[model samples]
Target: MDCDVLVVGAGAVGAVAALGLRRQGYRVRVLDAGQPMEAPTGEAIDPRVFALSPASIELLESLDLWPRLAPRAQGYAGMTVWDAVSGSDIRFRAAEFGLDGLGAIVENAALVSAAQAALDDVEFGAALAAVDETTDAVTVTTDDGRPVRARTLLLADGANSPGRQALGIAVSGRGYGGRAIVCHLRSERGHDVTAWQRFLPSGPVALLPLFDGRVSLVWSADDALADRLLALDDAAFSDAVTEATAGRLGALHTPTRRFAFPLRRQTAERFTTRRCVLLGDAAHVVHPLAGQGVNLGFDDLRALLVAMPDPDVGLRAAALRRYERARRADIAQMSQGIDGLDRLFSTANPAVSTVRGFGLHLADVVTPLKRRFAEVALGVKPGFPSASG
Candidate 1:
């Protein structure tokens, strides 16, 4: 009936946030409405794996989620970005950045399951009926007709957050004519735990190698192509993906059932309203080209934990404003950069293609610039979660 902190949503961000707050000496309660998805996102395998940056790993590690996740995780010591249409690509080595690995490829459901297991206690299947903010505390009523009272409420409900709306927080976002086709595929050669991304005329295709001989695919393509791929049978679909990706993985075979989600950019104008604060997808959503959506959520987790006030309401409006302002530029830069990259590479013009190819080659040749990217991708150059320098 009551808790020191109440988190709505048991997805990636919400689970992590609840665990973080609980570890901070607060009595935390989590409410999740969706049936906890088990065994990944497909019949054959889970295609919804995440490329966890070092920052995310560190955050989870601190919460003791990484150790439980290590057995299932696939680590990449480097990453390669190539232009499929043009023979241009850039290689990023973790060694160049003085890190052990570029990042880790983690199955999505596995991650939350691990995080929840590490947590002391978390309640599921309770839909939040209402969230009412008061001067001193916030009261949340659940579908089961139970009122969960908390000194502070964190809403991590997700991109199209009902919690944000119920709490009267203003959110802003717009859709891009892009959809991502995701699935798992087997390769002849081992990926060596390396992450690969190729930018095509339509959009970007990312191949994150898993522990086994398979790789999870995230292909951001145009609307029409997405529909076609979603409709294709398993056999035909594999061939289409391979052709679109140009057989980069030495022939992608055995594609599991595919799923697609619309792409969009969303950012809440106000991070905090009254006693409730927005975190994760509740705050913003960015293009997945750079794989920054969950990474942004990790950033939110770190910021809130590090800056939480003594009392839940101790978070001053000015401080919350500062946090929102600080995050705006980074989120905006990533959204604009990814959106621009999609626009630049999605064109069919000969001139634009030629220039983009040349730019890729330029990045490949520049050692310093390439290393900088490696550091950023490792998620530890600076301003990352907890790891410094």
Candidate 2:
């Protein structure tokens, strides 16, 4: 065999997976169809960012990637979520849960650069052309007619993973008919190291604090509204954001380019097949309302490592089964919960709005329930079985 494991894709998850597996004494090779990610330039921040949970931070620390990202990452000590229609809001603080902060906001490019720097080598420009799985091993052919064999293959490509399609793995989900707009804004008032989100009829709008005193905005709006918002000039767009957020951060001004991407929730039919398996976005894609998509992918990596402690027995059917079972429930629950929130908030029905308002208010006042929500967000109490189970 060319290696013990072949990781397809060199994104944050795939690079980290390869590093983890290699540290476990497994020979690992990584393949990516695109060139290596370039480091962020100048003082401008990438619009693509992720709110990484504590569990995810630990994973990165374990891989020694956190040190590189620590300088750039911003920790939000509190979060406030509200309903635009009902005027109901719920607030959470890390101190309430005996923690210093809730999570860290890191730019996507920074994460990719850090992971890639740690990765020994990656075969960029090599796409998976075909996969031939057997009882003992799996062999993958690249687009350039190169063949690579390994005891197992992991697909960490994005949601529309070509590697997954090549394996005939089907995904199930629906488009949200909306697009998420992301950009950094300069706020007149300080963010106070807080993350604020308000649910509107269009969708949810979030203002996440950045390390450099700027706020990263993620506004999910319906297709038509999103198009109109994107068409606005910088000043007009900033005004729209201020209005959407109810002027929570005072007058906001855009200092960077805006980006928008379609929203969708998808899950693969299965997480594994014979000697092949799916990880990260390849296995699941959840709505970004809760900013848990990337965190969930990190969870998948953690579970896979736990399920297969021994390289010799890790890729076996039993081990793979354990990993799949452990992750499916968590992913399904999160996806469904976020989708329900999206639906609940996107409606103009008076009765529905009233009930959701009351629900949010109740969750805010109920200490125990609010604590539970914080724990789940921190990944301290994963609502799924462990690998040993």
Steric overlap count per candidate: 0, 0
Highest lDDT model number: 2
lDDT of 2 by residue, 252-349 (tens): 99658989998999999999987888999999988788888788888899898988787877867788788889989988887877777788888878
C-alpha positional error of residue 176 in candidate 2 after TM-score superposition, expressed in Å? 0.6
Q: Model 2: which ten-residue window has the lowest total lDDT?
A: 380-389
Per-residue lDDT of 292-389 in model 1, one digit per residue for the tens?
77878888777777666444433444545555665677667656666677777777787887887887777677766554454434344522324522
Cα lDDT for residue 176, candidate 1? 79
- lDDT of every model, 2 decimals: 0.76, 0.85
Model 2 segments more than 4 A misplaced: 371-389
Measured by C-alpha RMSD in angstroms, how accurate is candidate 2?
2.3
